[model samples]
Target: MRWGEIIRRLVLIPPTLFGVAVIVFVLLRVVPGDPIAMMIPPGATPADIDRLRAFYGLDQPIPQQFVTWLGQALSGNFGRSISLHQRVFELVLARLPATLELALLATLIAVVLGVFAALIGVQLRGRRAEWIVDGGVGVLLAIPDFLWALILLLLFGVLIPWLPISGRIDPQIDIGFHSSFYLIESLLTGRFDVANALLHHMMLPALALALPFSALLARILKTSLAEAEDQDYAQIARARGFSRPEILLREVFPNALIPTVALGGVQITLLLGGTVLVERIFSYEGIGNMAIDAVINRDFPLIQGLILTFAALFIALNLAIDLVVTLLDPRLRHG
Candidate 1:
């Protein structure tokens, strides 16, 4: 990418973030429930409620409140959680690792499986094998990812009872001052046993998140691969006695991958959104679950912080994807 284009995209990030911040701030204030009301204890007088509201600065006009909050937010101060009484930023950071780990594992699974599936679908086009793959993709896409989580939970957690049903690791294991990533910490500490347990616990949730993403990616890549297969260079390469696999590996796959990389940002957003459901079902203490709790308790600061964090992540991931796509396809660098 040209320096000018890179600079332009970077400049857009702040305005996008500000728009999201404004929307969340306004919508939360307009909603029915009062955060102060939720915090008030039983038998508390009106004066007590007023005092609490004023203390949190909720009594201020909406415009003033938004300006104040936005200013604080720019400085990385998201204020205290109304319910938890802890710093919103701190709570989010604590839970962030689990969400990132789950998202990374899910994306890895999706990319690997999706690419292979797309290759198979294109190579075996019009055959029973391709049809079967198509049917499977259709099935996966038809169902929501959370339902997949539930099905896996039922099959493994209920029927087989093989994998641990809930949580990131066994409660019995006390990993001291470790990194938030369980497997990494376990490996670093030379506790192979704990690492093994962490992997086992993670598999089901990761699989639950991966299935739909993989299916979507496969469908997109399949179309791209098929189109690339008919391109002039691919036909020319075939005419030159290039093997089928060579033509695909050299010419088609890379083109297919460009579109896949672009689609990957959307897939990641889906995975992040799906994390809320998956984390809840698995009882995983990730940011998704924390966001859910924040919403339920009407914790405005926590909710604001979570939404902003998610928005920033989504923007960053898309920008990264654009850079990757540009690198993979040199034409994008100039365009």
Candidate 2:
């Protein structure tokens, strides 16, 4: 909340990213796989393999590789994907919008669902409805995001056949996209049909990712709401002849939201991480999905780039959340 604290956190980002880069670089090489060998065709000579390895600098020692990679990364050159043969930065940039879109949609869904559940739990306190809401949240929290993806796929994509299960959009749509953000670009260009299609395809996967986070948010908010309800301000509001709903809306909800907002920020980071599996399951071409391909192909550069990108996003999101929380909470503003 403090300017000094914000500055300190901002200053720590580089070292955090560097640590992530170092760990990923070392871990990737330590794994048993030869990216160069994978790149070479079957029956290729050792000379062919060596040439490719040297070309990608795989011939270097581990320490040299780390130094070289760190230097290049600091300079904004993440190198090319060993498998895809494209610039790692560009590849990640292209896929980033999809991941962001998915994560944002999921977060929106989560906040809405969570807030609704929390209100229901609070309003119906000591009733069966509250118990039902709590039970549902518990069940949702018990399931990981990946399993939710599978369940949603089966229920919506196969059994019900209501939504398109795979890919960002239907390949048959034949729309020209000026940007990777299909939904935004479509809506901006007055391509409502395309936008609709994009949402239809995205809905199930986004919902899958949202459910677990929604459950968590609901739990946190419900507890915060309960605590807020017991605060002296709420009793004062009641003594002032305000209705229960008015007290909740005006006095308790805002107080409850500070903690909820903090938890929401943390959940969003987890939602982004969850996209790695959910995107793959749905064949969504986000960076998370690309990360899977990078790992399978042992594309060291691409893998490293993706991890760093995610790390940066996580750090930035946490910083933004801290700022927002500080602004929202008067006590924190001074502290």
Candidate 3:
């Protein structure tokens, strides 16, 4: 990446995160819902509600409240969760690992399936093949992740009984460091049984996560490849007695990957935007779950913190993508 482009992206991240934090904070206040009313149990006296409001700083002016909360949050304080009755930071940290694991697992599955689809499209570039791939992508994209999760749960968990229905693991199983190795490492460690169980549990969610993302990546890759296929370099290379794979690999795929790299920023941003409903559907405890809880309970401070955290992540991921793009294609950085 050009040093300038890398620096530019780095510079842009903080302000963007700040903007998201402010927007979410203000918007939460704008929405209907008296935090005190939401927090207090029914039949509470007016005095009790007022005391609660004062305790949580709802009595303060909105600007004062936001600044005070923002200052504390920056110093690593997320305040108390009225619903969970725990420190918001601690609750978030506890639940974050499961969500991260889910995302990482899903991202891996998406990338692999997406690449596989791309390869298939490249190998079979005729009109019939294009139509088939297009139709598949369209259907997958149209189906929401939660619905897919429910269908898979019914098929694998209810009908087949081969995998547990939802939650990160079987409640009985202890998941410490021993649960770490999943694919090859597990096999090498003579933990094939555990590995199989892990994969079996993960497969449906992974498939659910993979389908929509793969559709997007495959569509992008297929289109890019199709365009690359017709470029003059490809024809020239083919005419010079180059092998088909050689021509495609050497002359096409590298160029095709540019669009993919460029769009990776939007994909990273989607992690926050797209994860909420799916996480709730699967009972997955990621930031989305945290956000949902905050919204339902009207935990203003916690909601702001969670949204800011997610926004920062989105900004950081986009910055990383831009940096990589600048490195791979310098034009992006200069412009």
TM-score each candidate.
0.94, 0.97, 0.87
lDDT of each: 0.88, 0.92, 0.74
Which numbered prediction scores highest in lDDT against the true structure?
2
Worst 10 residues of 3 by lDDT: 175-184
Error of 1 at 273 (Å): 1.7
Evaluated at residue 13, the lDDT of candidate 2 is 90
lDDT by residue (1-335, candidate 1, tens digit) is 77788899999999999999999999999999988878789999999988888877899999999999888877989989999999999899888988998888888898888888888888899788889999999998888888999999999999999999799888898767456777666778799988888878888899999999999999999999899999999999999999989999998888878887887666788788899989999988899988889999999999999999999988888788778888888897767
lDDT tens readout by residue for model 2, 1-335: 88899889989998898888888899999989888877788899988888888889999999998888878887989998999999999999999999999998999899899999999899998887888999999999999999999999999888999999999988889878888988888888999999999899899889999999999999999999999999999999999999988998999999999999987777788999999999999999899999999999999999999999999999999899989999999999987
Point out where model 1 deviates above 4 Å. Answer: 187-190
As a whole number from 0 to 100, the lDDT of residue 95 in candidate 2 is 97
Highest-TM-score candidate: 2
- Runs of candidate 3 with Cα error greater than 4 angstroms are 177-198, 330-335
Candidate 2 structure lDDT: 0.92
Predicted structure 3: lDDT: 0.74
Which 10 successive residues of model 2 have the least lDDT summed?
A: 33-42
